[model samples]
Target: MKLLTLRLTQNMHARSSLLALALCVGATSGEGALGIFEDHADIGATRRAGSAEYHAATQAYTVSGGGENMWFTNDAFHFVWKRVSGDVTLAADISFPTAGGNAHRKACLLIRQSLEPESAYADAVVHGDGLTSLQYRETRNARTYEIQSGVSGPKRLRIEKRGKYVSMSIAAEGEPLH
Candidate 1:
């Protein structure tokens, strides 16, 4: 199956589009939502907003800590929404430009976000170790579930939540996870 890969250049507009695509399709995240990046935690850098750089050719994003840099924290980034309802699904094409030093950078679907923008729920992340998994954060404690996945170009990450059950699925293309 051909991956739904999007080459992300250093285009702010493209990044914004990618952000929208990552958030709009799914229902609002609920507390105990169980996803990834439950808040506005920075993926690569904690101090610089939008510090990560995107490469169009490889469709990957890169970031380094500088000025208050820290490992990926839920407080530094999050998908903000006024309210979330119904079933939710997100498809992302992500890549990592570099990795190391507790970078823990990732691209995935964030959900159950509060309107505040500083808090929400997240799932589906491609870690710095080139591993993909699902995780959630509550009061500085993050719980991650290691799942077998190939982290590379044009990777597709998905999340679905219905009632009290939430599930994560990843694929390049060829039939959505059921």
Candidate 2:
């Protein structure tokens, strides 16, 4: 919850492009699929083909296809908080309970911390297909980069930013990617 401005560094220019892409993807979301921290989200209706069960104890929500076929199509979900700046680090544990049947299902972590409710500061996502990548957008233009990892399941993703330089490291909970 600490707010601090990032100082310009050597790699600021390169990382800026990555940051921009995150904003772009974060801005566009499927209708009713996007949920904020305080919002009451219906996981089944949002994805249009699944049922979501919220676990109050863990503060995490799980979505499952209640015997219905489903895929995450433009379904965007994010946690909102005060704008964060400086050398910030964000991490999350996510999984696709139904990933065994659908490879297109996905979950993502958003960072940067912005006041603009319409967009995120920066964000990255991992698809159920075992492709880990980062996506960012400044305004209308957006970009995606594939991370080098073919393993998937339960994952812990971390994004760290120092000045304009940013780096992402990911690993499965029980095994190493290498």
Candidate 3:
């Protein structure tokens, strides 16, 4: 599959989880009824409300929100998710609708243990500035960590989970995922 994973081995943390895509959510989540996603939410506090809109013609989901960050032991962002058991993978071609916003703004394909900001999770993320990386937390409330990709400005970010391992891959413009 093209949309998929991380260098962090199975030893990092071993727990099953549900997957999410940042493209769409209700309580603070279910409102993001965009195509494939069943629910959505704003994880953690934010300065303003966030939203997910699906464009049928273009088959794209536009998700926007504000948060302090998705780092450390907590995360703040709009989460478009569906809970499922077993291994899963998700991929997205991320782009900021407008330019010159927070360089750290991230669009991610995520798998979270729970909706809480402190949930254990894994993601393939691309920042506003085109930095792509694989990020994850080992356990609930654990510190988040990542391994940056040497390649930047990729057109697609993919995340995958298999057993206790998670990994990520990217494809640059006109290039295949490695």
Which candidate gets the maximum TM-score versus the true structure?
A: 3
Candidate 3 lDDT over residue span 61-174, tens digit each? 666565556779987766777777666666666665555555666677887888898988888887767788888899999999999999876777767677899888788755
Instruction: Assess every candidate by TM-score.
Output: 0.51, 0.49, 0.80
Across residues 1-178, which tens digit of lDDT does each residue of candidate 2 receive? 2111111111111111011111112222222222212232222223232333344434454443221111222212322232344565655555554424345444545553343333323455565566676544433222333444455443766556677765666776644322
Instruction: Report the number of clashing residue pairs per model.
Output: 19, 10, 19
Error of 3 at 29 (Å): 21
Error of 3 at 134 (Å): 0.6
Report the error of model 2 at residue 115, Å: 8.1
lDDT of each: 0.42, 0.38, 0.64
Which candidate wins on lDDT?
3
> In candidate 2, which residue pairs clash?
20-136, 20-137, 20-138, 21-136, 21-137, 22-135, 22-136, 22-137, 23-137, 24-137
Better of 1 and 2 by TM-score: 1
Ranking by lDDT: 3, 1, 2
lDDT of 3 at 22: 38
